[model samples]
Target: MKDFSDFFRNPHVWDREIVAVGGDLSSERLLYAYKNGIFPWSDQPILWYCLDPRGIFDLSKLHISKRVKRKINQKRYTITIDRAFEQVMRCCSHRPDEETWITELFIKGYTEFHKLGYAHSIEVWDEDGKLGGGVYGVAIGNFFAGESMFSFTPDFGKIGLFHLFEILKKDQFTLFDTQQLNIVTLGLGAYQISKKEYLRRLESAVGTGKKWTPPRVVF
Candidate 1:
C-alpha cells in the first residue's frame, strides 16, 4: 500500500470549509483522512470536509428520552456490534431522507477498512431477526467517527446509538465524532466545538491506541 500523505490538502485551510474535493476513496486514503479529522461526504466530485463547528457526542451528557428508554428496556431490538458492517452501510445509503454519498466505490473501500479492523458497525435487529436499523463509521484509537445511520422502524437508529455508547463507555473510548450536527443528533446530546478545538481533541483522541473491540451482546 502506498502512502496517501501527498494526496490530502492541508485541513487547516478550509477557504470554503472543504478540505479536499477530489481523491480516490482507497483504504489508505480514507484511513489517512479520518486520522486527520477529514472525511468524504456524498457529493458530486466526492467532496471531503472537516467542518468547522464540528458536532461530537459527550457520552457523559447523552440524553436518553423516556420513549427511547422504554424501547431499550423492552428489548424491542437486539444490539450487535461489528456483526453486519457492510449491511449497515448499505442500509444507511438507501435512507429515504436524501440521496446518499455511499456509492459502490465507497462501500468497497470501507469494506477493506473493515477487513483491516479500522472500520466498524452497530446493528439493530428486530425480534424477527431482521436488520431494523444501524450505524457505521471508522474507528481510530479512541475516536469513532460516525459516517451515517439509518432506521427501518422508528427510533431504531437511536436504539443502536444508545447501545453503541454503552459499549464505547465500557471500553473507555473518549470521542464519538458525529461530524455535522442535525436535529436527531442535537436531540441526542451532541454539542459543537470550533474546528480548531476539534482538531486539538482529535489529535489526542487518535493517539490513545485503543483497539476497537466487539461489544458484549445485548439480549
Candidate 2:
C-alpha cells in the first residue's frame, strides 16, 4: 500500500466533505481511507468522503427504550457475530425505497476484508433459522465503523445494533463510527462530534490493539 496518508494533509482537503474521488476499493486503500477518517460513499466513480460533524454512538451513552428492551428479553431472535457477513450486506443493499451504495464492487472489497478478519457482521436469526436482520462493518484495533444494517422483521435491525453495542462495550472498543446521522441512529442516541475531535479520537482508537471477540450468549 502506498503512503497516501499525506493526501489527507493537504489544506484543501478540509474544505469539503469529499476530499478525493476515483479509487479502487482494495483492502489496503479502504484501510488507509478509514484510518484517516474517510469512507467510500458511492461507486462507478467511487466518491470518498470525510464529513464534518461525524456521527458516532458513544457506547456509554447508548439509549435502549423500554420497548426494545422488552423485545430483547423475549429472545425472539438469536444473535451471532460474523455468521452471515455477505448476506447481511446484501440485505442492506436491497432497501426498496432508498438508493444504495453497497454495489457488487464494494461488497467484493469488504468481503475480502471480512476474510482477512478486519470486517465483521452481527446477525439476527429467527426461530426458523433464517436471517431476520443484521449489521456489518470494518474494525481496526478498537475503532469500528458501522457501514450499514437491514431488517426483515420489525425492529430486528435495531436488535442487532443493541447486541452490537453490548459487544463493543464489553470488548472495550473506543470508537463506534456511524459516519453520518439518520433518524434511526439518532433515536438510538447517536451524536455528532467535530471532525477535528473525531480524527483525534480515531488516531488513538485505531492503534489501541484491541481485538474484537465474539460475544458469549447473554440471553
Candidate 3:
C-alpha cells in the first residue's frame, strides 16, 4: 500500500485529484487520509478528492439568521452527540431530491471509523423525541472534516450545525472543514481557499493533538 506521504513525496500523483483508487478503508488509511487533507468520495472507481480552493467554515464569521436564532432559542429541539451515528448516516444517505453517494461500502467503512472514535455525529431531536436532523464527520487533532448532513424537518440541519459550532468552539478546535462549497454552506459563511493554504492550516491544526471526544454538554 502506497502511503499518503508517498503520494505527496512523489511528483506525478501529487498534482492529481484522485489520490489512490484501491486503498482499503482501514482505520490507518482513513486517519492518514484526513491528516493529509484527502477523503474518499462515493464515485465509481472510488476516487479520493482533495480539491483546490477547499471550502471551510470560519468560526468567527458563521451566520445564524434571525429565524434560526428564534428556533434555537425556542428550544423545540434537543441536541445529542454520537448517540445515533448509524441512524444519522442513514438519514444523510436517503434524501428525497438527489441520488445519495453514500454507498453501503462507504457506510461500512465509516461505521468502523466511528467505532474507533475517529468519526462522530451530531443529532437533533424534536420535542416529541423524534429525530429531526443530524450531521456527521471525521475529526483529527483540532480539525473536523464534515462528510454529510440531513434534515427531517425544516431547519433541523441548521440547528444541528449551530450546536456543532458550539461544541467545536468550546473545544478550541482551529478548523471546521466543509470539504466542498454549496449554496447552503456559502450562505452560512463558509468560504473557499486554495488547497495550498488549506494544507498549511491543516498542518498547524493536526499538530495541536486535540482529542476527538465529544464535548460534555448535551441538550
lDDT against the true structure, per candidate, is: 0.83, 0.85, 0.83
- Which tens-of-lDDT digit does each residue in 157-186 have in candidate 2? 889998888788877788999999999889
TM-score of 3: 0.92
Model 1 global lDDT (CA atoms, 0 to 1): 0.83
Best-fitting candidate, measured by lDDT? Answer: 2
The residue-by-residue lDDT of candidate 1 on 1-219, one tens digit each, is 355656667766654567777877777787788888889886468788888889999977889899889998999678888888899989988957677779998898898889888899989999899999998988888888888889998889888888888887887778889998899889889999988889888898889444587754665
Question: What TM-score do all the candidates reach, one by one?
Answer: 0.92, 0.93, 0.92
Residue range 63-152, candidate 3, lDDT tens digits = 989999999999988899998999999999997788887988888889998998889999999989999999999988889888888888
Off by over 4 Å in 3: 1-13, 208-210
Candidate 2 regions with alpha-carbon error over 4 angstroms: 6-13, 208-211, 215-219
On the 0 to 100 scale, the lDDT of residue 169 in model 3 is 86
Question: Residue 9, candidate 1: how far off, in angstroms?
Answer: 2.1
